[model samples]
Target: MKGLRKITPYVPGEQPNYSDMIKLNTNENPYPPSPKVTEALKNFNPESLKRYSSVDNFELKKALSDKFKLSPEHFLIGNGSDEVLAFCFLAFFNSSDPLLFPEITYGFYKVWADLFHIPFKEIPLKKDFSIDLDDYRQNNGGIILANPNAPTGLFQPLEAIEKLLSENADVIVIVDEAYIDFAGKSAITLLENHPNLIIVRTLSKANSLAGLRVGYAIGNPQYIRIAESIKSSFNPYSVDLLAETLATAAIEDTDYYDKITEKICQTREWFIRELHAVGFDSLPSKTNFVLSTHPKLEISDLYQHLEEQDVFVRYFPTIERLQSYLRISIGTQKEMASVLTIIKDYLSQLR
Candidate 1:
């Protein structure tokens, strides 16, 4: 079992796989995808399945380029951002020096590092859970920072990100903007001059296409080429035909994207305020999920109680800093209201 014994696998949030529960554990959008996505699915021809999926790289790449106003040569699409990230780690982070990343950011980064046998350093986050970029400027192999970092949901301003890119030109720097659609700014603007920079993104979070599994990386042409080469050598058709078409549809329907994101943000703000009004506090979040804890309540009991009520949220009960916290994904307004009611009822019974 050496393969299994190599490292601990990353544990994602629970998926109930049933429709009865109010699931908020995964950072998935509660809104439906653009109508265009549905239309694309309906119009698909079964005959296309016979041929190996031919993702129109020119078209999908052009769509991404037009949206970001970047060159088509600068983009590489993967099955998911996770695969894109894996490609990046393999393509760029091969040095003997330890790769650098925040200790508390996305869990999958560490998983990928271990799986690839890449040496990495887990730089500690500051007391407020903010990444101290200075800790990463040391001599290192490469870097991957998750903006609006996962589970905690705090966004680092674009200025700090720019500084990191500016100071660390020697190492490959990856900004995993999986949640950037919810957060305001993207570091894509920095790609023009920073040849060392790569921005990995996914439509899964904001487009309600978590099931579709499409993610892309944007960077300078040379770096993009390196990743694309690796991808081709491994799997020429990493993305299927239906996925490519639907993903393109989602990308083109920018209006639906904006509207749903606005709704999620609005709901997030209200949920934070309401949680505070009831004595539970949450971190200021730009992502569609909030990491929260009550000062006096036992987090474990609260987590279990909510689960019993058919309400599912994330609980990192074993992590030192996260033991007392529960990460709740933003759902529809009504779903969140139900969560508030349940939490208030649970707290009142304690009172």
Candidate 2:
């Protein structure tokens, strides 16, 4: 036990797989993957599994290259964005100064930093849960900003990001755009002028391929090379064959994803307004989920009641700032309507 690595692991959302439940906890796409992915899976050469997936990740990178207008060398595919971020933390954040991130952002950031023994500083978000860009002006080893940030779903504009990049040109700047498709434009456009910038994305959100576990990073070719070096040292065949085939198919079928994401956005807007009509108000979410709070109801009790009705949502009770809020993922229109009805019935019972 003495030699074992000791660190608190990141706690993921509860995943209870019940057929009849309204599962809007883990932020997965409420819809199925593209037809292209299904077709690719059906036709994928089973024998190819005997061989190791492309160590260079040529095909996956090529697919991303065509989509992002970057060459294959500028991309590095991973088992998920989590793995890609792990590699980035190891490869780039080595300076003596503390790494910087919003205190209320993704929980995994802190876990990865601690696991690697990397010094990190958690800059507090403003009272409204918006990131204070000015707080990141100090010296740091590296920077990571989760656009449309998690839990709160509030997006910081690219102009604010470019300002950070310009000031922090001495260190690496990572813009985690896992939710960017559901929000505004990506910071990938700034890569030409900022070699230190790396944009990490995942198919889990918009592409509806969360099960495939495919994610990639876009940056200057030099950074890509460095991440690839670290990846090869760790797991050369990190991405499997089936994942590559399905991920490639998902990336190419942009139209399907676009349609599904637009539907999700519409549902999120409607859900927020409906919550407001009740006594509950939610953050202006640009992601697939919203963080909401009720004036008179206990969120923990509401979460338990919803689960008893076979509806599941995320509640972060341990985090002091988030204890009163419930982070609900956007589901189908019918499913969301059911959730609303359940809440209304619950409120009526209280009266």
Candidate 3:
């Protein structure tokens, strides 16, 4: 811990201790995983627990490869997408050149850069909060971005991403698709043409398996081998026996995944309409959350009011441009109804 001064860690969203509050700060699925996941857990053989898990996670990688229509060699699994991203930082970026990303993107990008001692530049988003792709065409060792970016819930088009890849052929371009299942488009399809492209995804969001800690990356065999080296060098058994079993089962159950996604999308649209009716404006969101701001009330005041009513939401303080807005995760219909009611009462009092 003596030389830890160089490390400034990432701060995740708040998980408050108040039991009475309706927790919606983090974008967690309101539903449980498919029954198959439970079955995998219940029927697990205790004898297998004594042995170490498969070093390469062959079974899980193959299941994902089959589901995504890619070769197993192109896949790299990790404890979570965070670990995969960390591996990317170590394997791809160097100290001589730096990484490039949106200034308001996933906070972890900055943290990973600092942790690995890799220099980086934070490109400012345009007035509409969209990335200026031209800014990234300059000098850089690698590029990383959160598709359907966090905190803002905005996404860049694949065409724009392709342009970046086309121009920056020598560097690595990492697309973090943690919320892509909700967004409907994926950059994985582009990996065949761009060997330097890497897409990182997780079972946390759409698959509703955040607790399982399953994440994977898709890229050319060579780039994936780099990640493999980093992972093997650090911890070979990163994905344990139970997690691998559950993740494979979850990936196989396509019907359950589709049904939950459909439901979440439906709820997201309704929440947007209701938010607009209450004098708030929200950006179009392809993710499981909405970012909105009201003209009359301060965001801090609204955040506190919601908490006092036993409903929790997220608020970001560092970005002054977004300090007036709140990021609300789409819960179940019943949970959202409670949030809507609280908003109605609070706004009426303001009048």
State, as a TM-score between 0 and 1, how close model 1 is to the true structure: 0.97
Better of 2 and 3 by TM-score: 2
Compared with the true structure, what per-residue lDDT tens digits does model 1 show for residues 86-141? 99998999999999999988899999999889999999988888887878778899
- The true-versus-predicted C-alpha distance at residue 11 of model 3, in Å, is 1.1
Provide the clashing-pair count of each candidate structure.
0, 0, 0
> What TM-score goes with each of the models?
0.97, 0.99, 0.97
Q: List the residue pairs that clash in candidate 1.
A: none
Worst ten in a row by lDDT for model 2? 1-10
Q: For model 3, what is the error of residue 275's alpha carbon versus the real structure, in angstroms, after optimal superposition?
A: 0.6
Clashing pairs in 3: none
lDDT of 3 by residue, 252-303 (tens): 9999988998898899999999989988999889899999999999889999
Ranking by lDDT: 2, 1, 3
For model 3 the local lDDT of residue 276 reads 94
Q: Which candidate ranks first by TM-score, i.e. highest?
A: 2
Q: Is 1 or 2 the stronger prediction by TM-score?
A: 2
After superposition, candidate 3 runs with Cα above 4 Å error: 1-6, 17-20
